[model samples]
Target: MCYFLGAMPLQCVSGIFVLYSLCLLSFSPHCDGGNILVYPVDGSHWINMKILLQELHTRGHNISVIRSSTSWYIPEESPLYTSITIEMDEDVEDFFDVFLQEHLRAQRDGTSLLTFFKLTKGFLSMIARAHLLWSDATNQILNNKTLVKSLKDSQYDLVLVDPAIAPGVVLAKHLKLPLVLNVRWITSGEGHFVLAPSPLSYIPVPGSGSTDNMSFFQRVKNMFFYSLVLFQEKFLVGPIYDAMCDKYIEGGCNIVSLLQEADIWLFRSDFVFDFPRPTMPNAVYIGGFQCKPAQPLPADLEDFVQSAGEHGVIIMSLGTLVNTLPKEVTEEIASVFAKMPQKVIWKHKGEQPSTLGNNTLIVDWMPQKDLLGHPQIKVFVAHGGTNGVQEAIYHGVPVLGIPLFFDQYDNLLRLQERGAAKIIHLADVNGDTFEEGIKEVLYKDSYRQNMHRLSRLHKDQPLAPMDKAVFWVEYVIRNKGAAQLRTGAYKMPWYSYHSLDVLLFLISSTTLIFFSIIVMVRYLCYRRRNTKPKQS
Candidate 1:
């Protein structure tokens, strides 16, 4: 931007420029909302993203969303954002539904190393397919000259993307716009490993299911799990993005670097919910941003919860993805809930179980946050999704986690490490185990106390997490992206990033110097010996 608003003297330009920046800052806290182009991952990712959009809309930000035509969770029409739907051959939810059944069966089969490896393999397959679908969708957008031109013409200030899928990252780079990521998982793994210093010695990799303090073998397990993440990225998922970049994006980009190059990482993690770990300045923690003070529940639901009286209620939801468990497992859980004095509300969407309890209410959906914060609520039976876990922490409700798949166990472990949750392995899930877990979280005072302690810590933040997220998002728009916050390490190749090349050079130089000193000393000794013999 030029200092002069019009044709003016260069002498006055400097003073005007300084004043303009100060003026911009003075008024930028609230603007007619910056133009935000959102590329959101479907499914539960949309749930939290919708919250951000609602807030942005309230501030008068114009939002346009890129969605798949067959998106299961993202509806075609919404007042929050206009939709740009891309047609696709397949629905991701279709496979995910199939995968859920297989994944549950695989988990219930056993807990052996081989079984876990198989689970990893299955997960990689799903990730690879998902990436392919997103890449193809991105390619369609890039190839369409009209759409591409219009996207540019819209003059969006920045791209707000969930980096779990790299299509958005690739599209952001193609547009050459500032980027803000609503991210926890990227294409490879957790966002920290890509952008910050995550020494595996202490930081447990996702899917490893280890706590921050790990045993020797647990660390090895963590390392192995990390390798799987890398392998998935490099071999399984990376090539899809690479081909897209090669064809569509200028120059060439990889998903990992694109994620690292983002102007802001609105990380959905809090130190209270997560272990203490290194973070980047650009990585703003907006954990529990979706959480708020409980709103009034529906009259009928309130009546049900109030009927629990002193025993309080328990709520179970396995998220939108996992609609129902296998029949036998479902019956077992239903049976156990039937015997409990505390009432249970389960979010299930299928045939009612034969053993369903009189004291339980089954719903296709629930006001989960509202229920969690209710005074009559005592326990959360969760699948350990990050959103649910953070909400549980926000409401100070202890969890009985029956983690079904993908980072759920790890999320629960974070709570369990602090004694706020009890975990039961899926393979070990039965009536006895389910009942025992629920009882421990419900009856034990420590579980409630610890969770309450965590809730207090979470609530003690100076700025509401959502406000902090929005402020940084606006910060990117006002500054046109302050690249100074991002470190240059991500731009380096692995050899340079880790200093491996420097180490090799130093070793070779030291070896050469030592050899030369030895040779010089030997030559002097030989000359002295020869001269002494000649003199004699």
Candidate 2:
């Protein structure tokens, strides 16, 4: 009787398990016509988008991607993990290479940290034209009475716009669908420096005080330099960008304006890096969303690292854009590494340094994420790019950030502030500073503890970033743009947006004026009394 009772329930439990497994299996393949549109092009965007698309395909969600011709044209050397080979047309390749060459030139000139700021503005303006043209083209395609009639004729549940390629914003506006804006970095206000005037805060004067420190002659010269950029953005950037879109694609479409209306704004960095903004709910920090790296290291690199013994090896990478170090600086760094207690593995994409020290292993590329996960990697010398920063934290490795350009300073500073890393000034990146920063990161227990603390926080995320991104993408389809999470800050005035600062300034000014009037009144009374009389 007891055996028969147990067997009856066992069959029922098995039946339920089989049904659940079949349901999961039904949803797992990539198909062509999904009810989603992804845009604003980048490798990261493509990678994350592909994962979400794959999951959607498995789960039976339809997905379509709209990108610039050059969006997926990455060379084999860059670290991209995608199953599909992104084919690019010849004209697109030409346009992309030209843009890339110009972009590389801008990075090379951005050697000093402060100068990097100026160079970044020029670089952003350069890319902005390409993006504007691309976005215009995308919008034109979407607005084609035939295409629009057909798409509206059918159904696209939602629009997913990657901030990099950016045209997703335009299509979202045109389609009038709920928009999900995926920001891969510190975009938003920072990207505006390309199109708008730089505030007085961007002016580089030595003193910590106000802009009033400059001599009259120097201030005039600085103003001229500042105006040159402002004038260029006002007359050239906005108009030329407008003209390109107006002629080729959509008329009067602005990326920033589109972002203001996005149903959700997603950032790739952790919340610790993003400021506490009012739109915090719509702003989700989905950092380190990529598939986990396998524990095994590259056999060749692993063997080499193992041979180093107790000293361990240091891994250095300045990321893809600035992969090549100037020979002079490379030699100086090599000099320091040669004398150090550790072995060095530098990812040098250019020619190997002529100096060729015995302690260093210079390779064209290293699987950064995989290498960082390796047990043998002792310390990381990095450029403090967002991707690199997150990887370092995820692996609990200490970093020495040699920031070169574009939000790198801010990233490095944030990491340094968090006690996870040390910063090496670009101008001072000679042997002493580089060596000292490295030694500190390698030797310090506090640095390791701090990085571990962040790693724990990163791991403790409510849901993995990839899962969160995929869930949100599907949620947008089901609910038509997670509108419940959208804050009304988009409609607020700029002054009102920064109201606390405005209030502080007003109160300080009013207090100063009131005190001055009081002093003046007392002085006048004393003067009149003195003149009228000692006689009284």
The top-ranked prediction according to lDDT is 1
For residue 345, model 1's alpha carbon misses the true position, in angstroms, by 1.4
- TM-scores of the candidates are 0.92, 0.70
Where does candidate 1 have its weakest 10-residue lDDT segment? 1-10
True-structure RMSD for candidate 2: 9.2
Worst 10 residues of 2 by lDDT: 78-87
Q: For residues 181-203, could you state the per-residue lDDT of candidate 2 as single tens digits?
A: 66753122333232223344433
Tens digit per residue, CA lDDT, model 1, 130-222: 889888877889999999999999999999999999798889899999999999989988989988899999999988888888999999999
lDDT of 2: 0.64
Which stretches of model 2 miss by more than 4 angstroms?
1-34, 43-60, 71-121, 139-154, 184-254, 275-277, 291-293, 492-536
